[model samples]
Target: MKDSLIQSTDSAYSYPLLIKNLLQAPLVSAPDQEIVYRGDRRFSYREFAERVRRLASALTSLGVKAGDTVAVMDWDSHRYLECFFAVPMIGAVLHTINVRLSPEQILYTIDHAEDDVLLLNSEFLPILDQIRGRIDTVKDYVLLHDDGPVPDSHLTFSGEYESLLAAASTDYLFPDFDENTRATTFYTTGTTGFPKGVYFSHRQLVLHTLGVLAALSTPAVQGRLHRDDVYMPITPMFHVHAWGLPYIATTMGLKQVYPGRYMPDHLLELIDREKVTFSHCVPTILHMLLKSPLSRTIDLSRWKVIIGGAVMTRALCLEAMQLGIDLFTGYGMSETCPILTLAHLKPEMLDESPEVQADIRCKTGLPLPLVDLRVVSDGMENVSRDGRSTGEIVVRAPWLTQGYLKDHKNSEKLWEGGYLHTNDVATIDHQGYVKITDRTKDVIKVAGEWLSSLELEDILLHHPAVGEVAVIGQPDEKWGERPLALVVPKAGATAPVTEKAILLHMRGYADKGLISKQVVLLRVRFVEAIDKTSVGKINKVALREKYLA
Candidate 1:
């Protein structure tokens, strides 16, 4: 009976049927609702749906078939949003190629993905021009342009975005798709040896969308996902599918504001003009906004933000709270559908003091419903939730990728024992709050003791002069390993030479006393907003290679 029930559950509630139903829903329900671009160009759901159908039609005409990969290389724009739905809705896999990577890496992904067609924003033409010869499997280049002469390239199919839609039929039929059919493929930014791909099934994506929606609106967590809510995704679309916001907006009928090129001033303008109620971005973006000149001109009280991609500092969180922004944090990874836990208040604590609420908001958060999170020590022993003992975080969820595309070895590592290993070392309290202590790769080992780089970095960042800091382990014959601090001084500030000055600040903490004995503060040579991944993580792997390796 149990076996039969499990089989029955898998057969019902899939991605293909959901899209058909969503398409039939009231297009004009949010018809006047705008997906703003560049503070000017906009598209409502009704108009957006029409364009999506046309694009689907155009893609089919060009021989795009089910199971083929379609690559989109661009910033956040209306065109990118359309491709997010149209590509998958039509049964082709949408590969959001990371634009921040090197031209060679970009070309490698296109070739590895075996992209059937490449859709690019006109601005990327220069880089594409150099790599166009390297992408062997790509047969067509569909230009997604706003206003400019068509870029000249060897590939023939070049035309304005609107023209292609105008010529194509909006009546193309969307095929019935299986929930297990791969809908999207995004490469891991940490692809060192050879890039590995994680594909999302339609069912997984739909579930993720619903989970994200629930996480945002549950009064305990209070996300800005209400019907009247307007959102601006400061996170790039290529990263974790912009943390699944665009799709969530589609399903929830949100009025979205897209900031092209990610200029600080432009983001502020959009937030003010569109009256945006919600957004998700990294802590660095919040830092920039707090320091940006445009910040003084706009009213931030209307906004609520979810900070991720890195640890959110208490200083920044308090600062945002002072500005009347409802601040929260979430934890997830590229392999686990990106959102597994969020630092949202529970019903019992909703009426707690602001100080208590803020304290709760500091932790990584409770695991979302349907996501089972556990912290394990020595790979197998589950750690107690006393909030003292730390362990590696592992998760199991319906939305997690089955395995890396074509690489069974690492894929096996990713899903060992049916749980996705996060590689993030954290501790959980009795209240179910998770506080990350260190990354498995970033932990500093000294005299058989493990010191958290994340903990050290957090402490150093509190220093007024410290702009950014990364703690890495360096070989030490006496201690076995020692902590090497790479410090990025605050803008227009100089780094201090004495280790005493650094230790003076962290003197009281017991961890600091141990760390102080082995801490070596090294002035960072190149520190311009430390290189981040597409998802806004401080790319510690890259930093370790540059500094420690």
Candidate 2:
């Protein structure tokens, strides 16, 4: 009986077979459901599927051979969502470029991926003009806007998206390829250096989608999402394949909605008008939405938001809870098909107090099934689940990146000892909830002992006058390094701050032996505001470059 159970689990986890079955399922299952944009333009599942078919045919006709790379640069639009399926259906890998990247880095990724064709929004014409000569491998350019003329450039441009759709046969056949054939490739938003490319296979995408749905998340079980649920992922399709929700949403027959260009006001209007039930993005985006003026007028109580890409603080979680929105925190990276852990409460925690449940829901939740997650210190030794011992988190999963594209040195660093080593240092509780302390790279080793800059930053934020804080290690010959805090004060605060006062606050923490005694506040600089990633987490990489570079 035990053997049979193991075998059944293995069979159910197969990726290729699952994807094939999903693609073949009836399209009418998501009937009357819509993918909306700008509150007015939208497409039903019938029309959406037709567009995807047309896209597939267009790419194949443009000599997009199986295993070739197809790159996309656009906002979260219905057109970008179509490429999520169309490119892979023809066995070619889809590479979603981060439009937020610098022109030079964008060129590096396009050149590194050896993209065969590029699909871009006409809005990026200025940036494209700067790097047109650098990308030599791209054979065709497919422009994806209906209202504008193609931007003039020296490159070999082909046709507009609408024109291609008209020229190609929508009934062009989708060829069957091995499940392991690379389906998508995306560059990680590297904090320090040029972005690193990560690729995923069809099997991996299928498995991730199934696990995302089958998991005991509130939207899956509590929301009663059938084949008819409407999903509008506010997360950009270019980032980690929008955490793979675009594919899963469509395959599950869920009506999808995309907020074109991702204006917060537009997204809010779509949610209210389209009656969107499901969406996902980083915590900061939600923070903006909750604080945005539009949020006051829009109806948001019915939306189910999946927050990931960074840790969720108690304050942020409570704010969402107050709105009666079903917000759950998730954890993953670009390398692991990006779905490592979810903060959904376990069945055993169902009877626990609301506070206790909320704590678990804020930590990195239990690992998805088949994901072997562990926290280890210097060695591969597992840390105690007593919620105190924090260590580097590592994972082993089938869908992890093969390696950084063309960068073997970092790729090997990514998979040390046959496991994907996540630099995130964290602690797990008795119930298996993990809380991240800091990244291993971000940790400061003063006098050969660890000091958490995150902890220091968190404590500094408690100051009545401080609004935001970031702490980074600076070079020191004596202790090897020292910590410095960068703060952004709250608007219109009368209480002035100084380096001495900030360090005095730390003295109490240091005297109690909570922080390093060797820690010294070298300097303090007040800025207009701290910068952040597109997803809203503090951009420490930029800070390091500006201060420590």
Candidate 3:
């Protein structure tokens, strides 16, 4: 390669790609845009910037400085949005604690991340009390309350959130730093072991924000996000920066609504009251909302939702479309700054039948800009671009995390060939669409042939009485391993679901050549519910242990 280095004048400004720089255009273009909380409280982007400065001053008074770790444990709210910008803008790494995690994992993550200052919501006070003495790194605490004054708790707060913000000056300036400095870190909610920390730099987050904004704001028929669109996030802000949409929203100066805690009816009411136009979430949350009685009475025609964290079932997609809701899929994980692909329908495909559209929508998606996604074999060679053939997904992207924090051994495994290994098995078709068939550990090998558990689950979801389903591998004396499915029947199913009934349903698909004939050996179990991870993904590792062990 030719040497491309160039020199600049001595006085030239090397503008770094810092998170604070993302504010410049929005402050001018949309200074008056509103950021609302739970459909009621509201503030302008002008005030938001001032609050960010005030927060920086407050955190500094509490001894937070450049390179310190500031942790937050709160639900999705305007307060979380302030932290998203303020904490990083002041040259500190923000750790968004996954409050849904078990108390033990919560403690482990807090200590593991070496949190220096913790700003906590009152609802999480009990949890803090449970492990107050055990925490080692948190030197100061700030209370965050929504309804009233801070309640009684064992942990002492250095100050309350709003009080500090109101008392501080808006003149506190954020200093420039290296764009590669770590901006955010959060733990992955894996099913097997203690969560591993993933960190992203200021450069990575800015790039992710711009890339996702470019993808979502681009011209499209159904799911494009525009300035006129009102945005809400069903995904928690703590999880991968709410898949990094908050930053993108702030960058574009879009009207934002934060639903503090995810409650179905409450979300529906907010959607109706605020006329929410764009949002994203996991499949489980969407399913719960569609099942709610209030959702039936509301007008969802103006809404568009992007589904991730788990596969979006064809049934759910069709149901949303019938209600005039524009729903699609997005793909990524905590380590990737959480945006890799989106399943927006192509222009021509927009005129196709609803069934064909849902078929496309349920596929993983087309990779986002700057995302080099591939399905490769064990040797790191690319697999054929045929929809039928499957291999592991490996990718190269500007925003992908360099490695797991403080863990040397597993980090190398994650980037074995300089490409981040996703451990997900997928296939890319001629049109460049990527469809994940199954996780490497989740794929079932039956009768010497590999079978996709995701495929089995998607097919079973079509059953009239089936509500939710997960497929796992079970040992069979003859075949070595067979597919066993756990099914959750619809709430008001007219007919009781039996093992034989579901097995017969699987046989129907096998007969149609839609699946492997080995599905003939499938077994079924009815359950009240499927187990999920902390972030609401199906926990197959737990399922295999519970059902097979």
Candidate 4:
């Protein structure tokens, strides 16, 4: 009830937090640290900075100006890293187009973002060829290719990416601007409608980088990312800035390796060849790595991975630990500048058994610095930190997306009560570690009891023959809804895993009172594969429509 505002002093210098400033520490301290692309190209941080400047100059030559939108559709490469800085540093908003989206969705986003210039990989040229004329706002294109002669394409390109950068001067100066100016934009992989645009400002990105750096630097021995650690991102760069780790990695000047497209054999090869110490990805990617034949031959003891974009099951955590890989869960959504919490262990908890540690690592984790996270009921009352009382997770942080671009109704709903609603149902323990039980929409109510589909999926994953599983609620005559699981079997399993075996597995947990007796109502179906979103999350929305509809 007091006036807490303070007036600015004339002599005090206000430093605006900008993306360009993040390069200062690394450039001064570790200029020679390397950034590698696949196994082919490598360059120092000093050269990386120079290339960023050159890229900005190239965009300028293409008539890119402050406030203009420059879009990119390419694989994860050194080129994408340059754009992460150069485009925003020069004051133009960078739009990281999700290449995995359907052609129509991609066209819709390109048009919706009003992209002025597009930099696309040659692999996606055919996709563009399919809908070239429908793309209204794009005036120019820059082609990105890895090796060999450039393939012929129908669309007119301004020039190739490296050629333009090579021809530009590295002497261009990046000017300072308002910290709150929009720096980047990308469309969210929304479930029901066309993807919604999420934009972040320069200030928000800077804050997010610092917050993530602090959280990952916590003194936990397992998953901490330090300057000496070699970095690779299993998450796609197009997805929430690969959960915003690239900036943190670049700021720290760590040795970075970019895998063009995620291939199991290649990723494992890179892990062994480059001695990759730290990386992050969705649960599906981790599963693929574990199932890869190369994973059996490689030494993964030195690797540390953070899993996000989906739940990290206990089975997956145990498998990684057995291979000496330090794996854990991180929690956030596209609306969050993506990292909100990390499942790192406390010093005292570090000595626990592997089973206990695996359970701890699979948790959603403790909130990062400057993040205000809470679980509240429908009435907006705070939920008890009892670990069993589930509620919606809501948070406020300097880096959270302000709102969906051009969507007033959903934006208001997202920011209701001044806290960004995560739409995830979770519980917090006395120790402040959060365990997400389910998405608000994914929680299944059976005969008046709430059953966590995530919980059931985790239990099913513990079965030896069950490779990957997704659980959804199906209408039942007796119970309001019953848990139905779609499962993918592990390759080369000695025995086939039937629905009866899966039910018996759940019944064992019910018999031991580990879960409710109603869990006996669970059903399972075998599937060839599970569907995934653009960012590698299990597409539960699509699954529900496929099986239950």
Candidate 5:
């Protein structure tokens, strides 16, 4: 009997859900599909797989071993995609360093992750130079650049990226390991003290990829992602694995375009030149793309965009729809593998009026597959799903980070009551749709009444003249705080837009019982631009420091 059991165990293959397995389908189905970068360099999936193997060989040669963390600082590119697979395939953790962080913050993250190797683009060399001495954990550096010879730098390097790949073997065999092994790590772009590190395992990532793929692929006619769709991510690769969509795209073997460093006009050119179809970005990026003068020249009618990393306003959704572009909202955070819900319109609602559709498209959206999402009160009881009662958004998913890296206290707080706290105040309807009202910190209180800054911003965005807006809470003597609005008027707005006009627009909604009449205490200002976070989110922390402090 013991011999029979041992024979059965040896005969059955126990397949582990490692990051390397994501490439299997793509390799067979679309081996020749082109992965383009910057409308310049291009390679087929057949060659891309070779590059992944070569990269693994290179890293292994440079002393990278299982469990070592390999950090990379680069813009969106094919090389980064190779790093995405190769590092994790070899059982090493990939730390996607956010290059936008301050020099001091960057140093802190490197040390915190204990990164063993660094893959850096030449453009950000100056940043490393400023804090290189302080980055004690990194043992070797690999440089990446677009053209010309490598520039002279003081820091010693292992080798240039392309050179290393060219010299390495393309026949490296990747061994399988436990699925719970750490796969990736990166710090959050928090406005608080220090950016906290977050991590995911091989098992969590595989499940997240499958869950998101199922969600994107099942949408009937609205927001489906198929093998034929051309994938481009406007979201930074260093940001939460570019919301973990690259893995999905690769798994489906979709043609992908990676714009190196984002330039609005250049991005428009790439979309037009490459015939790109599906993409995702923060609201700021989408706004910038619309604002580009080249927007009028390009044919954007074929594009489908997923807006995330921030709340997308109704005005922006309307504008995109008017241009015949399909736009929707995706909701998640840096701690949750960065995707939870997508606001894909149901087929029945596709026949609705454009205005009504815009309202639906701008919602935070329904939770994705395997996402156990809830809005709960202080005691952890689920809130009523009447769409009017609001509470904190909590979630339990297969891929949520177990905890903040090295942060035990905050991790305990994040996972209190067996759910990850999102710190977002929101409501859910009977249809299981989540509509976020505001960040708990950003909510305004007046006369002992609560107000949602996001709701106020959404209302003001309906104004014809308001191009972009941010609402924040300002301290008040009579009330704890009142909402303040900073508006950016569109170039050549059809009608005159002023503080009074904006106030009247919001007040109309308040009078209709859509919002709190406490907005009567609201104030407005016209600013050239609003401050943004390192990852292009509206920097409420900076705004509060500048205006309210």
Candidate 6:
């Protein structure tokens, strides 16, 4: 009986969670659903499936086979969306290149990924031209252009993206394989050292898609992402699969609009034109939209946006709420396939004031279903859920990347204990909401007391004069490190917003015991803009080098 239980049956069939499976539901149920790419093109899901197959066939004909890597350097567009499915479906890994990286970094990633085939947009030709000789593994190039004639290039081109798709047959078979096969890879934008490549498996991605769907659909009042919603991704598709929403959007058969590049006016226009109901981005993008002159002219009331990739301040949340936008925070990193928690409101808390709701909405939030999240101390003990005892966030989930690609040392550090360490310091409330205080390395230590840089930044953001703010620890002999703030004043403010004025405002909070009394406003420098990561999160590492260094 024991042997029989362990043995496989001849009649048994195993189902693998491949990317191809994700296409089935949408094809059958919403075949006619529309997919728009900026103002240039539009196609139905029926056409989308055919295009995906054609793309797969084209790549296959060009010597792409199972286990090969295909790299793409393009803006967020329908072409990218097609590659997201087609490459993986053909049993090849998709490398979503971050075009915003420096030329050297771009070269490093391309070489490191060992990309076999590259799909290049005409805009990025200069970048390739600079490093063409150094690129080792890439054998073929496919050019992509949006408008006008495809410009002549020095690099050898196999064929144009559209022309290849047009000539290729749409009946190629996408074979089934082990669900654990690696599907996609992209380098993480780390502050120190070279960017680390984080890859996800087919099983991981499909599970992540399902996990996201369950989280969004289960929520009652706010933060629900449904089928009827028109979706657009402001988050770059190259970044953690646009926080993994593109897969979710496609799986749900939502009408997806791809804004080619993140221009504030263009994004606003697309939102107004497409009646785009849902989107996701980091805080800086939202701030940019609010600052745009065109934003005041558009109707943003119907837009539901998920803010991730950085700390979402209460000030920003309040401003978005005032505009009738549904904005909330989500928590994850590149290592975790990026969506672990979301700051969706509870049913009991629905009656709270907008200000109160905004505060909750900006929190790190509870764990998504099947996400085993814990805040742990140095000894690996779980921290108290008192909403004050902060610890490193360690997690165990089905979808997290096993480790960094080809970097065993960092991979072990990433998964030191049984759980994967997130390197973020956070606390949990009795109600199970996780609020991140600061990254483990970003905490400001003043006379042995740790102050959250994020907390200070949040407090500074409450000041009406401040448009955007970033807080970092400055070296100090007296106290180990002092908190320094860089602020950008709101546009059209008549009041003289000085460093002293902002310091005084923070001092008021310090006196009232609202924040740590140790957190005296040491200095505030008003700046025109804050530096951001490629994906739009505040680049505190860059600011530290500029100011504190």
lDDT per residue (tens digit) for residues 179-278 in model 6: 9999999999866677999999999999999998999988875888888899999999999999999999999999999999789999999999999999
Which prediction has more favorable lDDT, 1 or 2?
1
- TM-score rank, highest first? 3, 4, 6, 5, 1, 2
Off by over 4 Å in 1: 1-28, 150-152, 347-358, 492-499, 508-529
Model 4 TM-score, 2 decimals: 0.98
TM-score of each: 0.92, 0.88, 0.99, 0.98, 0.97, 0.97
* lDDT: worst 10-residue window of model 5: 1-10
Give each model's whole-structure lDDT. 0.80, 0.78, 0.92, 0.92, 0.92, 0.91
Of the two candidates 1 and 4, the one with more favorable lDDT, higher being better, is 4
Among these predictions, the greatest TM-score belongs to 3
lDDT per residue for candidate 3 within 114-166, as digits (tens), equals 99999999999989888879999999999889896767888888998999999
Residue 48, candidate 5: Cα error in Å is 0.4
Supply candidate 1's per-residue lDDT for 251: 76
lDDT by residue (tens digit), candidate 5, 381-476? 889999989999999999999999999999999999889999999999998889998899999989899998888888888887888889998888
Tens-digit lDDT track for model 1 on 1-549? Answer: 456544557658544533445544436466767788887898878888888999998889889999899999888988888888899988899999989877888888888888999888887888888876677898888887776586676666655567788999989878786777888899888635546788888888888887877877776345546888888899899988898888887777788888888988878888888898889989988888888877877899878888888888777777777777888898887787789988987778768776677767778898888998999987578899899899999898888999998888999998888778888999999988998988888888888877888777777777777777777777778887777777767785666534566666655454546444444432234355565665567777777777666
- Once model 4 is optimally superposed onto the true structure by TM-score, how far is the C-alpha of residue 277 displaced, in angstroms? 0.3
| 149-190: candidate 4 lDDT, tens digit per residue | 777778898998889989999999999889999999999997
Report the lDDT of model 1 for residue 121: 82
TM-score of 6: 0.97
Q: Candidate 4 — what's its lDDT?
A: 0.92
Per-residue accuracy of model 2 over 1-549 as CA lDDT, tens digit each = 456443466547443542434554547466456777656677877787788889888888889988899999988888888888788888888999989888998998899999999998888878888886778789998887746466676655688897888787778676566888888898988767788889888888888877776663343343234555568887788899898877777777776777777677777887887788888888768866876688877777777777888776655666676676767778899899888887775557657765665666677777887789999978889999999899989998877888988889999998998889999999998888888888887887778877777777766765667766787888878878777678887665788877777778778877898777766533567766777875567887788888887
